[model samples]
Target chain A: MGLIDNINKLFDHRIRLGIMSILMVNDDVDFNRLKELLDVTDGNLASHTKTLENAEYIKVEKAFIGKKPNTKYFITPLGKQAFKKHIDALEDLIRNPK
Target chain B: MGLIDNINKLFDHRIRLGIMSILMVNDDVDFNRLKELLDVTDGNLASHTKTLENAEYIKVEKAFIGKKPNTKYFITPLGKQAFKKHIDALEDLIRNPK
Candidate 1:
């Protein structure tokens, strides 16, 4: 639902983009799981996830897997396209560096 | 000197990474020009530039072009490599997005 903005810079911010890129590769990553992998704080993870959710780059689902609650995340189609455009832009940059 | 990091999301920040990528292709760019092109504020651009400068991803030179002062920015060798790695990471993301 969004056009390809120069997402290199938009999604290139380490934390936010990391969340999206990882989610794209993994079917579903839980909050604590990503937090451990990225070594980011809980608040940091939550805030970045909120921003991605607002941008519709990812979808978040909350459920229970036994007694404990679980949160799962997935990259959206729009996000995949955006990531593709960003990669294309990067490739262009690599081939045309001054 | 630095190794390739997962830059897919690192340089993707619109302001910071745009600054680097534009500088790469254009040789150098002025602060005001970038501010106008990116439609960012003075403070926002300044802060973001500081972050890049701190990361050693760019070099800023302050000089005078007549009576007024001018600031010029260029991507360093380290910065260029970092940008390359980031692009590579983005490409990886694009090729294998889930």
Candidate 2:
């Protein structure tokens, strides 16, 4: 009940939801790969990533790829828990609508 | 590829996604009941319902329940098709991350 409200607010945006969904299944997602998969602009992906990162739902890893820097993202334990909860809330809403 | 992008844009909002999910399983849902289930305000639900209605994903039915007006929603055939496609697209994004 209350959990559903939280779930709705947290995953209200599609880009954010997509980011979580991608990070949930993959071991670690690269910045470029997310942009490609989500097909969002660089600015769009960066802003959304920042939101998730600020929430501590994801941790960013940076490395040097030759001369260029590569960024990768990994879901934290907390992120996994929250994302799972959100999914479960959605399922509950679908299965048992009051 | 392109499909994922379209899917992202279409189901980007949680409320819209929620509406589709609820209607998917139930034959018809009342407006007030939806407000109760989603735990959203009247204005909030109305705006979201308008969006989904504009998308033609759900059809609205109006009837009088004892002198009171009752508005119920049912997913149209097209709506069902789109919802299924959107889900398949999400599954594709999750299962085969390419």
Candidate 3:
């Protein structure tokens, strides 16, 4: 195998990658904003978000915003570490090709 | 939404991403080399390689080496451009936090 072989399979999807990419920069991202940013359907976003949630790579918060339900996502420490390691693996493969 | 909307869905899988990363630096890669480098099952590698081939992102070559069957892969110009754009989008997202 290459220098780094293990790449987290969780962020292998485009939607999940989009979610992580956005969350890496923003501390808190609302459901609507994530949907908008990823340009994914409500179902699509929810399904992928659920996967990340199950993996505990992200945390979700639900609250009432002036009588309206609102949900937001934040990357956890574990999530950040995993994401960074995944990126490092990619970079390593890019730099060294066997 | 981020500056780049499309991130090339073809590379959303870890195996496919690995294939592209390795092919980016090396001009030609044999099937056994990829199989060993990625450490993927024979079926897994073939399936994913077929996907990339269908997308026209990679080209495959079949030959005989000393009476042994062999196969190789190379990235096309379109694939190189797509991979570069995909990486650029990732770096852009990393640099800019919306």
Candidate 3 displacement at residue B33 in angstroms: 0.7
DockQ of each: 0.30, 0.40, 0.56
lDDT of 1 by residue, B1-98 (tens): 11113754446566676677678787788898878766788998899899899888898999999989999988889988988777676555445533
Which residue segments of model 2 deviate by more than 4 Å? A6-8, A95-98, B6-8
Model 1 chain B lowest lDDT segment of ten? B1-10
Clashing pairs in 1: A8-B12, A9-B12, A9-B13, A9-B14, A10-B12, A10-B14, A12-B9, A12-B10, A12-B12, A13-B13
User: What DockQ does candidate 1 score?
Assistant: 0.30
The candidates score, on chain A by TM-score, as follows: 0.85, 0.91, 0.93
Candidate 2: tens digits of C-alpha lDDT, residues A35-83: 9877888998899899899899999999989999999999999998998
Best by TM-score: 3
Give the candidate number with the greatest DockQ. Answer: 3
Q: TM-score of model 2 relative to the true fold? A: 0.84
Docking class of 2: acceptable
Candidate closer to the true structure by DockQ (higher is better), 1 or 3? 3
Fnat of each prediction? 0.27, 0.34, 0.52
Best-to-worst order by TM-score is 3, 2, 1
My TM-score estimates for the predictions, one after another, are 0.67, 0.84, 0.92
Evaluated at residue B45, the lDDT of candidate 3 is: 92
Q: Write the per-residue lDDT of candidate 2 for residues B1-98, one digit (tens) a residue.
A: 53256464556677777778889988999998888877788898889888888888898999999999999999989888998787776666545645
TM-score per model for chain B alone? 0.87, 0.90, 0.93
